[model samples]
Every structure is written in structure tokens, then in C-alpha cells.
Target: MTGTAFDLPLEVLRARQNVKWRKYAPDVLPAWVAEMDFSVAYPIRRAIERTVREQDYGYPQRNGQNAELLLAQAFADRMQDRFGWTADPALVQPLADLVQGTFAALWAFADANDGIILQIPAYPPFHSSIAETGRRLVPHRMHSDGSRHTLDTAALEGLVDARTRVILLCNPQNPTGRMFSRAELLEIGRIAIARDLVIVSDEIHADLVYDGRRHIPIASLSPEIAARTVTITSPTKSFNIPGLRCGVMHFGDAALLARFRARVPGHMLGAPGIIGIDATVAAWAESQPWLDRVLVQLHANRARLDAFLAIELPQVKWHQPEATYLGWLDCSALRLPGTAFDFFHNKARIAFSPGEAFDPACKDFVRINFATSTAILDQILDRMATAVRALG
Candidate 1:
């Protein structure tokens, strides 16, 4: 409690009822979900407690010292200060979470059966979002050079056609953790612009980039790109407060905002809870020191994971991520009897996200969440090593 929040003991973590801890059996070591095992930032905690104490629980207000307006302004200011991107506070709309924002954008921008291009291996929810909305999922596979992953822009262009209406992008991309460079973003923007497709960029992992890398919002590439983009992001991932249920979607211009509003309507989207709004504002405005500490811990964990794979589990290969805490491990080399996820679960009592969930072709891979304490991570690595060695 006194030092870095990432050092929390497993017993303490298991006592909480979050999905990441509760989803597995007692013997299982879970490294599947995106949420971190770290404690909440002090500022975020204080803000939630203060809101509860004040009995400020009411329908959220839109103006005059209210949570919604404050959150919008904070988001804009944070964007400017952190990424050198100027966002319009007036265009920022609150949502229950990023998934909801994605659903809303798909519904607002595309007709039923319209094609949406998504890069894989992608966040699992993105696949479901498109399917649930009746949109055709055009999978654009990322090019992997056995070590690094890059967007296959040529494949992306080929996927687009008369039916395609949207390009759904995840930056500091999920699972893979590749923070797309500005040049890559420019190419994507070029495709979207040429095809007149709307770009819905999920930037929830924007704050978690490792090393000296910076996350560039695709919408920030130019005025033309911004005019056709909808950026959805939140403080939940960075501040470890996803249970708070707060997120924002920013439309590039007034017309794009109007188009979305016309389809979904403001009331249908429903606002985040007052508690969520307050915590988010606190996260953006007063939690930088806490975030800085977390970044340092994550960087160390990433390096430790890289070393473990090299020395102990060299059969498993991966591209060290540029951002996010997730590690996509290629387990094809292990030649397990079944999927790597099941092998780890049954043999090592460790649960990782099955790669097939992201894409059917990724059955030989599994994604590990490395945002836990050094002890937990070491235990996971040890379990993995033992399981792999048993193959002999």
C-alpha cells in the first residue's frame, strides 16, 4: 500500500471480486484479461469516495460545474497536453464504456450488412461488435516477420470495396501491443480518405506505450483525417478503473457528430454514472504521478517476460510490444496436443486468452496479460516452463 501498487500480494488480489480474479478456478493463475492487478490510484479512489460522501448521485447534468462537462474538458486538455492533439470539448460524448462506443459508431455510420475492415489479431470484442451489429467483418491480417507485426496496408486496401463503410482501428493495438507509427497511420488515413470511409479509432491503450514511443491518434494525422474519424478512449485502462464504466467518443467535426446523433440519439447512448465521471476526471487531471509509476512497473514486467521466453521457454516466440500490458505468444513451436490456451490451463493451471478468440487462424497463439506483480509474473513463467518441459 505504501509503495508501488503493482506489488500487491496474490491473496489480496483474489479477495476482490473483479472478473480477472474471479473468472478462473482457485488453482488457476489467470493472465487472460486486460485489467491490471494493481491497486487503484489514490486520486481516483479519493474522487469516488468524495462523490459518494456528497450524495451527488443523480442523473448527470450537461452544464454548469457538472461531471459530463468537466470530463469533456479534461479529455480535451489531456489530449492537448499529452499528445499535442487539439480536440474539441464540445464534440466529446460520454458512454458507458468503449465497447458501447464501438457499437454506437457501427450502428450510426453503417447500414446492416455493410462491410467493416478490422485488423487481426485484434481485441476479441471488436469481432463480436461487428457480428452482433450484422456488419460484414473484413479481416485485414497484420504482417508478422516472425518478430515484429506491421499493418498490411496493401491487404487493407484490397479488402475495401463497394460494401465497405468503416475501418475500425485499435491503436497501441490490443494483444499485439504494436503502437502504429505516424507513417503507418498516414497510409491508413490515405485509404480511408480515398474510399470515403469512416474511421472509428479505439485508443483506450493510448497511455500505456512502453519505452520512448508515443501513441499517435489517427485522427490527429491531419484535418482531413480528423473530419472523417471518431476517436473513442477512456481513463479506465491507464488508471485501472474499468469497473467505473466511463468512456468518451470524440467526433472529428460538427457534421460527423450530427450524423451519429441523428442515428443513435443522445438519450439512447445514456450517460456514465456520476461516480464514473468524477473518477475519470480525477484520473485525467490529478493522477499523472500514479500513472508514471505504473508505466515504470509495466516496462519492467515486459522486459522480464521477454527474458523468460528467451531463456526458459524459447519454444514460444513473440514480438515485444511497444505498448499495452498484453503479450501475444506464438505457441505453434510448442506443438501441444491442443490449443496453447487449453494446454496451459490443464498442464500448468494457468489461464491465458485463447488466440482463436481473436482470429480462427491464431489457434496456435495465446495472449498473456503481464500487468501483475513481479511475483505473479514469475510464477506464471515458472508454470509455463514446467508445462513445456513436461512435453519431453
Candidate 2:
């Protein structure tokens, strides 16, 4: 309780009921899920506390000084200040979460059986979102050159067809952790524009880039891209508040916003709770210092994991992530008896996200979440080493 946000004791984390901690048995170390093991930023906690204390729970209002408008303004201001993307507060709308935003976007834009082009080994929910919305998933696998991953724009070009209506993009991409460069984004934008497709960009990890690399919003590349883009982002990932369920979808202009609203009814996308809205406002407007501290811990953790893999478990392969706490590890070289996730879970007692969940072809991969304390991370790595060595 007294240490840095990321250094919470295992017992302390286990006491919580969040899925990250409770999804598996207590004996299983969870290096899976995207949730971080950091304490809530003080500002966000204070905002939630104030909302509860004041008994402010009510229907969210969109007018002046209400939760909705404040959230919109805060998000717009954060976009401008952080990424130089001038977002319109009027076009910002809230949703229960990014997945909901994605579903709504697909429902509003693409018809059933239409295709959505998505990079493979993507965030698992993206696959589900496409399926749930009755859209075909056109998988575009990223290229990995042993050191890093890059967009396969050339391969991407062939995947699009007349039926493709949307290009779902994830920046600071999940699992692999590659932050698509501006030039890469421009190419994607060009394709979307030429193909007459909408681009739904998931940018929840924009604030978590490391090594001083900045995240570029794909829609920011050009007016044409923006007009065709629907940006979905939230403070949950960077601020470690997923349970709050607050996310925003920004349409480029009134016309684009109107197109969406006309199809997806407002009532279907219920507003976030009063606490969620207030916590989000505090996260965007007043939690940079806390985020900076968390990032420092995450940076150290990433390096530690990289060194541990290289020295202690050299058979494992991965691309050092430019952003986010997730590590996409390729355990194919180890020739484990089963899938990497199963081997780790059964032998190491550490649960990782199975790569097959992201893409069927990545069965040899397992995504590890390294956002815990140094002590816990060391334990996780040590267990992994022991598990791998036991095979010998």
C-alpha cells in the first residue's frame, strides 16, 4: 500500500475480485489479461469518491456542466494536448466500453455478411466484434522479422474487395505491441479512402507508448481519413480503470456522426454511470503524474522481461513492445509438449493469454502481461524458466 503504484503485494492484488486476479485459481499466476496491477490514480479515485459521497447517480445529461459534456470536453482537450488532434467536443459520445462502440459502429456502417479488414493476432474481442455484428473478418497478418513487427500493407491490399466495408485498426497493436508508424497509417488511410471504407480505430493504448515514441491517430493523417474514421478510445487501459466502463467514440464531423446516430439508436448505447464519467474526467484532466510513475515501472518491467527471456529463456522469441504492457512471446522454438499457454499454465502455474485466441495461426504464441510489481514479475519469469528447464 505504501510503495509505487505498480509494486502492490501479491496478497493485496489477490484480495481484489477483478477477473485478472480471480479468473484462475489463487495458485495460478496471471500474466494474462490486459488489466494492470496498479493502484488507481488518486485523482480518479477522488472523483469516484466525490460522486458517491454526493449521491450524484442520475441519468447523464449532455448539456453544460453535466457528466456527459464534461467527459466530451475532457476527451477533446486530451486529444489536442497529447496528440495535436483537434477533436470536436460536440461529436464525442460515450459508451459502456470500446467493444460496444465497435459493435455499434459496425451495425451502423456495414451490412450483415460485409467484410471487415483486420490485422491478424489482433485483440481477441475485435474478432468477436466482427462476428457478433455478422461481418466477415478479412485477416491481414503482420510481418515479423525476428526483431520487430511491421504492417503488411502489401498483403493488406489484396484482402480488400467489394464486400469489405470497414477496416478495423488497433494502434500500439495488441499482443505484438508494434506501434504503427505515421507512414504506415497513411498507407492504410489511402486504402480506406480509395476503397470507400470506414476505418474504426481502437486507440486505447495511445498514452502508453514507451521510449519516447508518440502514438499517431490514423485519422489525424488527413481530412479524408478523418471524414471516414471513427476513433474509439478510453482512459481504462492507460489509467487502469477498466471496471469503470467508460469509453468514447469520436466521429470526424457532424455528417459522419449523424450517419451513425441514424442507424444505432442512442438508447442502445447506454451512458456510463456517474462514477465512470467522473473518474474518466479526472483521468484525462488530472492524472498525468500518476500515469508517468506507472509508465516508469512498466518500462523497467519490460526491460526486465526482455533480459530474462534472452538470458534465462533464450528459446523464447519476441519483439520488444513499443507500447503497452503486453508481451507477445513465440514459444515455438521450445517444442513444448502442448501449446505454450497450456505448458506455462500446467508446469509454470502461470496463465498467459493463448495466442490462438487472437489468431488461429499463432498457436505457438502466448501473450504475457508484465504490468505487475518487480517482485511479482520476477516470480513469473522465474517460474517460466523453471518450467521450460524442466522439459530438459
**TM-scores for every candidate against the unseen true structure:** 0.97, 0.97
Q: Give the TM-score of candidate 2.
A: 0.97
lDDT, each prediction: 0.91, 0.90
The candidate that achieves the highest lDDT relative to the unseen native structure: 1
lDDT of 2 by residue, 1-392 (tens): 23574467889899998999999989999989899988889999898887678786667554556678888899999998899999888998888888999989999989999999998899999999999989999988887886798788888888989899999999979978999998899999999888899999999999998999989998788889999999999999999999999989999888889999999877889888878888898999999999999999899889989999989999999988999999999999998767888999999999999999999888889999999888888889999999889899
**Positional deviation of residue 214's Cα in model 2 after best superposition, in angstroms:** 0.7
117-200 in candidate 1: lDDT tens per residue? 999998999999999999999988987887689888878889999999999999989989999889889999999999999999
- Candidate 1 matches the true fold with a TM-score of 0.97
What local lDDT does model 1 show for residue 351? Answer: 93
